[model samples]
Target chain A: MAAIPEALAELVSDMESISDRNERAELLIETADRFGDFRVPASIASKPYPEDHRVKACESDAYVWAVDRPDGTLDFYFDVLNPQGLSAMAMSTILAETLNGQPLDSVAAVNSEIVFKLFGKDLSMGKGAGLMGIISVVQTEAKKRLAAR
Target chain B: MSVSITERGYVNPGVLVSTDWVAEHQQDANVRIIESNEDPLLYSAGHIAGAVQVDWTRDLNDQLRRDYLNKASFEALMSRIGVTHDTTIVLYGDKNNWWATYAFWVFQLFGHTNAKVMDGGRAKWEKEGRPLTREIPAYAPTAYTAPERDDASIRAFRDQVLKHVEAGGPLVDVRSPAEYTGEKLHMPEYPQEGAIRGGHIPGAKSVPWARAVNTEDGTFKPAEELKQIYEQEQGLDPNSELIAYCRIGERSSHTWFVLTYLLGFKNVKNYDGSWTEWGNLVGVPIEK
Candidate 1:
C-alpha cells in the first residue's frame, strides 16, 4: 500500500468516522459539490469511451488524470461526468486528497481497497462501488508516470 | 431517413420535451425541473436556473432500507420539494439521463405521471450552451399527495422475473455486454455488484442500455429507431408484459423509459431489484 499523504489523511478519517449512513451519503454529496465548484470545462471533463482514462467500470463517463508535481509527488484530479454520482465524486476526492501530495512511488502503490479497509464492510454499496474502484486507476496512472520518470 | 429527435411518433409526446421547451417553461408555475444526476453534486455546480436537485440515494431511497421510501415518505418528499399533483415534472441529469430515468421510474412507482424527461438531459442542455445557475431554490412547499407505490404495474420483483422467464416473456438486459454475459463483473480490490453466477435470465435478450440512446448528445434515439431495435430487432411485442433489468435497477430504468414512455407499450415494468437480486438468489435459473 502507498503512504497516506498528510493532507488527505484527515479527509479519510472524516469520511470513515461518519456513523450515520445518510450523513455519510451527504458527505459524499458535499465533496462532489466542491468538485463541481471547480467547474472543469466539458472539453476537459468529458472523456468518451476508448480515451483510456475513462472510468468505464462504472456507468458514468468519469475520467481521472494524475499530474506529476515538480517535487516528484502526484496530484490527482478526476471528474465523474454524471451529476447524480456524488458517491463517485467523493471517491475521487478521497484519492485526490489522499494521494495529491504523496511521493510518486507511494502513490503508485496506493491500494484500491483503501475504502473497504477504511469503511469496512458497512457500505451497502450496490453493484459494487464503481467510483471507489477508481483508486486502482489513479494508482496505475501514478505508476505509469513514475516509470516515465 | 431519421426523424427529428424532438418529434417522435408516440401516443404520449409528453414523455420527452426539448431543452428549449424546458427553457421556455422554466418560469411556468405548473412545471418543475428536477436535476437528478449520477454525480450527487452536479446541481450545486450550476444546474438549470430554476431546477431543484433530487438525491436518488437520499430523497427517493429508503434511508434505512434497500428499497425506496414508503408511500407516506414519498408523499412527504413530493410536498417538501414543492411538487403538487398536477405539477409537470421534467427530469434531467448526466449519464445520458440514466438517473433521470431512474427518478422518473421511481415517480411512476408512486403513480406520478405528470413527469417527463428533458431530452438529452444535462448533456444536451450544456452542449447547447444553455444557461446554468447555482441558485438553490427555496420555493414554497405545496400540497402533494401520492398513492401507495403501485409495484404490480411498473416494478418487478425476483419471483416475478423468474416466472416471466419460465413463460418465455420478453426481458431486456440493459447492462453492458460484459455484465449481461456475467464476465468481468468485479475487481481484485472491489467486490463488484454481480450475481454469484454470471450470464442472464433464461429467456432474456441483451439490449445493452446504451443502444436506446444516442451517445453523441446523450439523447434518446427517434421513436422509429427505438421501435426497430426493441421490436424489429429484439422481437419484443408492444402488447406483451416487458421487463428490463441491469446490475442494479438504475440502468434498466432507462430501457423501461424507452418502452413504457417512448414506444407507448401498454404494460412495462422496471425490475428495480434486478441483477443483484437475480444473481444472488439460491435456486433461480440462469442463462450463459
Candidate 2:
C-alpha cells in the first residue's frame, strides 16, 4: 500500500505560502476529504532526530544522550535538564546497565531510580520489558508469515 | 438496527475521522480542520494547506491565571472557534501527537464528541506525502450548542483529585521522570523546581507518556497491549477511577484518550491543573 496518497501530496508540497488561518483550515478539510482513512503503523509517525543527541552533566543540569552501539540504529536518548547533584558517572553507569542488560550492584541500584521509595528502581526496565514483549510477539508473527509464504 | 445507548457513546458524536478520511469527506461543508500550532507567525511559513492556525497556549488558554478549563471560558472558546456540535472538527499540532491529544481532550471536556485527534497528526499527514497547501480557507461562524457538561467524564479541580486519592483511585503521572520526581519542573522556564516541591502526588504512579506509544509514529499502542501495560505494569485497575496528569494536563490528556477511547476504561479523567497547579500550591501535600 502507498504510504501517502497522491492528492494529499500535492497539498503538503505547496503549504509554504498559506497565511490566513481560515483558508488553511478549509484546505485541511479539503485534503482530509481526499485522504483521511489511511492507516499506518503507530511506530512510523514521529519525525526522527537520531543524529542530534547529546549528554551534559553539571551541578544543576544533567542532560544525557548516548548511543548504546555505534551502529546508531537503537540509541537511547535521555535529557535531564536539571540534576539535584546527581553524579555523571553514576548516571551513565545506570543507563548502561538499564540499556545494555549489565548487572547493577547494590549502591548502583539504590541510586538508579533516584526516588528509590517512589516509582521503584529499574525505571527504564518497563520499557525494556515492553520492547522484549513486542519483539517476541513480532518474531512469532514473522515466523507464521514466513511459513505461510 | 438502532444502536443501543451504551454503544452510542463510543461512536464519537463528532468527526472522529482520520486525516485521510477527512480528506475524502472535506466536501461535507460543515467540517473544519484547524492546525493548532504553538506559533501562528511561524505557522504562516507553512501549515496543512488551507488549514487555519490556532495558538493553543495563548489563544485557547485563559492566560490571566492558570484557570483554562473552566466551563464558562471553555464555552466561549468553542463559540469563538466557530465550532458547533454538528461541525466535523479535527484538531492537530506539531511534535507528533503531543498537542493534538490536548486539543482532543479539550473538545471532549466541552461535551463535543465529534472531535478527534487526526491519527499520526500533521507529522504522518506530511510524511505520507499528502498535499500541504498555502491558501487558507475561511469558515462561516457556526452556532455550537453544548449539552450539559459531562463532569464525570473529565478530571476537574484539586477537590475531585483529592477525592480520587482518598478513594484509592489510580492517579497516573504522564510526565517525564524529571518532572514527576521534582528533578526538573518546567523546561526552559520557571526555577526548574518542577510543578511541585516534592515528587508526585500521593498514590500516583509514574508512567511516562511516551511508553504508551510507539516512538516512531504518534499513534497509540495496540488495544490489547495498552490494556496489559495499564493493568499489569502500571497497576491500573480498569474498574477503578483512573485520573492522569502532566505539567499542564497535556500529556495526561493523551493517556485519558487511550484509557477511555482505546482501552475502554469506563471511568477516566484528565486532571486539567496537572502538576502546574497541583505542585505550585503552598500547602498541598506531595509524595516522593
Candidate 3:
C-alpha cells in the first residue's frame, strides 16, 4: 500500500489528539472559514462546472478540479455550491492544503477514514458520506494522474 | 415570489413560520429559536443571531445504543437549551430543514407539541440576506420535565412495518429512486453500506422527500401542489394509516412533517427503523 501523504498524516495525528468535541468543531469551523483561499479560481473553472467533476452523493453540490504541477504533483481546487455546506468546504480546504503538490502515488492512497479522525465519530451518516465523497474525488484525481504516467 | 405559509392553503399553517416571523421573534422571551443541523461545523461557523443549536447525533440520540435519549436526557437537553413547556420552539437548519424536521420528530416523541419549523430553513433565511452571528448565546437553565417518549403514536418499529406490509397498508419510500430500485446499495462513494440488502418494503410508494419542497428556495411547495403529488399522483389516501421511511429515518421525518402538518394526514407515522432495519431483516418482503 502507498504511504499516507506526510502532511495529511500529521494533520490526522494533530486532530486525533483533541478530545473535546467543541474544540474540534472550533478547529474545523476555523478551517472552513479559510475555504475562500482554496476555491477553484475563475481561470481554472467557473460556474456550471462539468457534471463529471461533481462529487456524487454529496448534497452540497461539491465540484473538484486538479491541475498538474511541473514536478509531476497535482494542485487541487474545490467549489461547494451550497453556501451552507460548511463541512464540505472544510474537507475541501483540508485536502487542498495537505494533498496539493504531493506525490501522485501517496495522494492516491489517502484514505477516507481521515474524515472520522478530523470530524470525530458522531458524524451523521449523510454528512459523513458527503465529506468522504470530497476525499474520494481528490483520491480519484490523483489515481487518474498516476495512470496517465 | 412564493406564497406565504398561510396563503399556501395548508391544513396546519401554524406549524410553519416564515423568516420574517423568526426575525421578529428572535428576542421574544416566549420563543426559543433552535438550529439543528447535520453538519457539526455550521452551528459554530455562524447561525441566526441568538439561536441555539441542537445537534441531532449528540443531543438527540442516545450515546451508547442506537436509540434516542431517554426521559432524563431529554429533560436535561431541554434544560440546557432553556426551554420550558410553554416556550414556542422554532426550528430551522441546513439541508432544507432535514435535520430540523428530524429534531422536530424527536421532540414530538416527548410530547413537545408546542414547536414550529421555520419555513425554507437556513437556506431561505440566508438567501433573503438575513444576518448570522458566531456568538453563542447563554441562557439560564429551565426546570424542564418531559413525559416518557411515546413511540407508538408516530413511530413504527420493524415488526409494525412488516405487519403494515402484510396488511397492504400504504408506505412512502422517501429515498432517492436509485435506492428505491436497488440500483445502488448506498449513496455514491459512501463507505458504509446502509444495508446488506437493497430495494424497498413491499407496497411502498416512491415519493422522494424533496418533491414536497420547492428546490429553488427550499420552502415547501404550496399545499395544492403537494396534494397533487401525494394524494392525486401517488394515490395516497390522506385519511388512511400511512408510514414513511428512508435510509435511517432522517429524510422520512421530513416527509412525515409534510404529510402530517402540511396536508393533515390523519394517521401518519415515521418508520424510524426505516430501510436500514427492514432491508437487512430476514423474511421481510422487499420490492424493487
* Leading candidate by DockQ: 3
Q: Candidate 1 lDDT, tens digit per residue, B1-288?
A: 324544667657778888879999999999999999665446766799889888787788887868988998988888877999889999998878988999999998888989999988898898788899867787888877778788888889888888888888988898778777877454444444545777788788899888988877877888888899999998999899999888779888998888887898888888887877887789988887
Regions more than 4 Å wrong, model 3: B187-193
Number of clashes found in candidate 2? 52
**TM-score of candidate 1 relative to the true fold:** 0.82
Report chain A TM-scores, every model: 0.75, 0.21, 0.96
Question: Candidate 3, A82: how far from true, in Å?
Answer: 1.0
Specify the highest-TM-score model's number. Answer: 3
Global local distance difference test of model 3: 0.91
In candidate 3, how many Å is residue A49 off? 0.9
Q: What does the lDDT read for residue A79 in candidate 2?
A: 31
Ranking by DockQ: 3, 1, 2
Q: Give each model a TM-score.
A: 0.82, 0.60, 0.97
Q: Over the stretch B1-288, how does candidate 2's per-residue lDDT look in tens digits?
A: 222213334423233345677577556656667776432222444556556555556555666665455666666666766677777677776545666677777767677777666666666666667776666566665565665556566766788888778777779998778767877655222233245364788888898877766556554555556767787887888777778888767778878877777667778888877787788888776887
CA lDDT of every candidate: 0.76, 0.54, 0.91
Kept native contacts, fraction for each prediction: 0.29, 0.00, 0.89
Writing each residue's lDDT as its tens digit, candidate 3 over B1-288 gives: 789999999999999999999999999999999999988888888899989999888899998887889999999999999999999999999888999999999999999999999999998999999899989999999999999999899999998988888999999999989999988786544444378788989999999999999989999999999999999999999999999999889999999999999999998999988887887788888898
Question: In CAPRI terms, where does candidate 3 land?
Answer: medium
Give per-residue CA lDDT, model 1, range A1-149, as digits (tens): 55656655666677667766545655665666567533335655444534677765665556777665788776666777665465666677667656777787777666566665444344335323665557668778877876787
